[model samples]
Target: MRRFERIHDIVEPVEGYRRGGYHPVHLHDIYNQRYEIIGKLSHGQFSTVWLAYDRLLQQHVALKTLKADASKNNKELSTLRHLSATNPDHPGKRHVLELLDYFEHDGPNGTHLCLVLPVMVSDGEGMTVNGKSHEATYVRSISKQILLGLDFLHTLSIVHCDLQPANIMVSTEAAAHSETFLQPPEFNPARWLKGMTADESAPNYLIATQRRRGQLDSADWSELSVKIGDLGGGGREGNHRKSVAPTALRVPELIHQNKTWNASIDAWALGCLICELATNEPLFPLGIFGLSAEQIDHEHLSLIGGLLDGDGQINETFVKHLTDRLPPDFGAENIQHLASFLGLMLQQDPLKRMSTVELLKHPFLVGDIEG
Candidate 1:
């Protein structure tokens, strides 16, 4: 019998794996006879997420599978464990995804690490019920929740390197009544490990992969809560990984490749995310330039570069007057307050950016503010 590898041995950002050439798990294929695959949720660079039903708990779950060979020392499992132990004190704060269970399974791709997570819905559910923009109140509420989640992570010195729209999911009341039918795989880890690693067993009718996509009803949007998902790019304060947020959401510090950055980088990302949520469009549509990576960096700097005065400290006057420079869409209602908040979050210098703890206390979080 082969022994399971130690958890600490796994590292973040495993390389060399791709979405193609991997083994396929059939419909109704159950692992340990505990989780039955209902549908494929999505695929990533090194793993595939499947929507499954928990036979023991009788609830829906998202199962993420990572090829064991490519998954050395999985950091996400450890991060979830640490977060669970830390336990944020806010009762209403359900902004982070909860890890229910995890185990190893052998497939045609060799051994795979499977993580059981709660299924998530879309975030834009109820905001546009009337077809007008999402009100400032709803935007404030969601932003507060995201800040609280960030505060929890920053308190523990963890940096969520990615915080894009895709990583933020919404949970709705309707999901409780949803149901699906699927068959379960027979329990036998040893047998599956010794099982064939070829793709010949795949059913002719089955597609190699399926994508799970969802949209929320406008009425349900108000009842929806946001949770930050996908911590695969996250790590302890100084892990030094390249390219944190998605291109459009990338902060100056990350774009500059400064290795000394800490949790404040997340502040920049949260700022960009909040702007998009408020405007229903990307804060910085860097793709419009369509330049190479180096040129794109310059374009980003040009937008926020003026925040830095000759002395290099944050120009209080510059950020204070940001409303004049920013477009009207950011504020829709309370322009001054929103512009000030974005200024604080989008500081050109990482050190000058507001910490999550400080950002949570800003006037913007409470209500509208004067410049």
Candidate 2:
């Protein structure tokens, strides 16, 4: 009895958290040893991503600094670990974002967990791989790489809940570290230029002209590689939102109160974003505060929904799952522009919607001249 009690004491504490919480990892909180938190780039509900420098490896990386919300962080860590494990054998998991190191930091409120991500290109916002701003080509490059990343995640039965230009990064040999820099170089505003210089434009280019290359260069898009991110909303879904896109670049099932959403939802969002990127505009420009193109954040959704709905009289039971109310009167005409393309992706019925794999084969992407 005493021996069992002794054994129980030793095992209980270990099992309590190592099993109940955390990523089954025991790592250091040292900055220089592992990574140097450079600056805060973006913040999410549970984590703040950092522009970090890896001292050991000596490279620039984006670090997801998680605020220990307890519930949220625990969930993210476990899922990432699970994906990393199950993903090893999955064909889709190959060469995505390789988990380099895990660590924690002391915070005023509590301890914060962090994940280090490799920095691709600084061409986010309007920036481009060439340091100058361009369009079309950059959009195609971003879309194709994102597709590759999604394809891998889909193979593992994972749906990246959140994917956007802000989440995707550009990877290129030209973008690689120069050994001394050992990180994605910090862009100098004054140094930003347009088009390659004379000699460099051909073969033996001048070093000075390299930075000014066009932002929309086909190379930017061609060099795109993807890394699926922010699984906070990531998961498998049942059919529901087929009739609508979710509030945030969502599919119909997601918006129509879907019970089961899957890779298709992710595909739907990806397509919409690609459409917006292609035009250098928001597919659903209505800001979170501002809804559809007609204004009013949640007006009729008619304009948005019209792109997908047809016949005006499909079975209500079939669509009731997608939405509870009739969408706003988008007039007799439907949104045939980008929304129409997105409409096909948001096919309320999962069977009808395009799968991530299928989307990769679409003419919208596959037939890209620039890509």
Candidate 2: tens digits of C-alpha lDDT, residues 31-118: 6367764443444445445556677776777667565545444655666777677746644463356566677754434455777666
lDDT at residue 18 of model 2 (Cα atoms): 20
Error of 1 at 79 (Å): 0.7
lDDT of each: 0.64, 0.48
Q: What does candidate 1 score in Cα RMSD to the true structure?
A: 8.5
**How many Å off is the CA of 163 in candidate 1?**
1.0
Tens-digit lDDT track for model 1 on 126-229?
23222345555666777888888778777778889888876776766566335422123222111122343523322222232232223453434367677887
Which whole-number lDDT from 0 to 100 does residue 166 have in model 2? 53
- Output the TM-score of candidate 1: 0.76
Q: Candidate 2 — what's its lDDT?
A: 0.48
The CA lDDT at 186 in model 1 is: 26
Model 1 clash number: 8
Best by lDDT: 1
Shift of residue 250 alpha carbon in model 2, Å: 2.5
